[model samples]
Target: MRTPHSHNFAGKTRVSVLLACAALLAGCKKEPAAGPVPGGDAQQGLRLVTQYQCGACHTIPGVQGAAGEQAPSLAHIGRLSYIAGGIPNHPANMMQWLRTPHAVKPGTEMPPMGLTEQEARHMAAFLYTLR
Candidate 1:
């Protein structure tokens, strides 16, 4: 003969198993909420530039480049007259370019990157420090 407390515990165990199964079934469903990170790291963005071999094309001061030819560097992007091939330079635009290059220049070689808005800003900040 089982005690009253044991029966209550058994009922709770069954309820827990049911809730677990419900949760397992819920995991089979799909949801749509994939998006870019809200903010980014500029220093990490700069590091990523080197890590992703961007220096091969761009003539950045610190990073090394294997190619004999180098693209215009960001040594002083903050002070430049224009960016994105001379479409008017601004930190926001620079961040836009850093995030989505193709949107700014359709046939440019520079590709979108792994930087966040904050990171791009930080990167812009770092670049401003160059000169």
Candidate 2:
């Protein structure tokens, strides 16, 4: 008496439930992909941030007493859709922004910290893990 559409929907539901159970039973706890993200050490980046005196202008989460009033809080920077609310929020863009804030956003108040590419990458790596 049931329609073919009902049978199809029930089959789809059963498949979905089976897939979910299989995923749960598999203990899916995969670690994040290894790459530049894992390549750069967060601890090293933390040290660099302090060494560069970034806390003076920005509020960072892990760094001790890094709460500054001049800049935005980077506590959730990883989840931001854009850098400076304009450029795409990718690691490369972040590194460029960190190295040359003025170039990215001319007339901006953020100063150039004179960080090398590698250093900026390390910082970006750390920032991307903020989420």
TM-score of 2: 0.70
For model 2, what is the alpha-carbon lDDT of residue 96? Answer: 85
Highest lDDT scorer: 2
Query: Candidate 2 at residue 110, lDDT?
Result: 86
**For candidate 2, what's the RMSD?**
10.7
Candidate 2 structure quality by residue, lDDT tens digits, 64-127: 8798989998888887778686887777678889999998999888899999988988888888
RMSD of each: 17.2, 10.7
* Backbone clash numbers for all candidates listed: 6, 0
TM-score of every candidate = 0.54, 0.70
Model 2 pairs whose backbones collide: none
Candidate 1, residue 48: how far the Cα is off, in Å: 3.6
lDDT of 1 by residue, 36-105 (tens): 2235444665676667676677767766562425467666655566776676665666668877888888
Off by over 4 Å in 1: 1-45, 64-70
lDDT of 2 at 73: 87
Candidate 1 C-alpha error for residue 122, in Å: 2.0
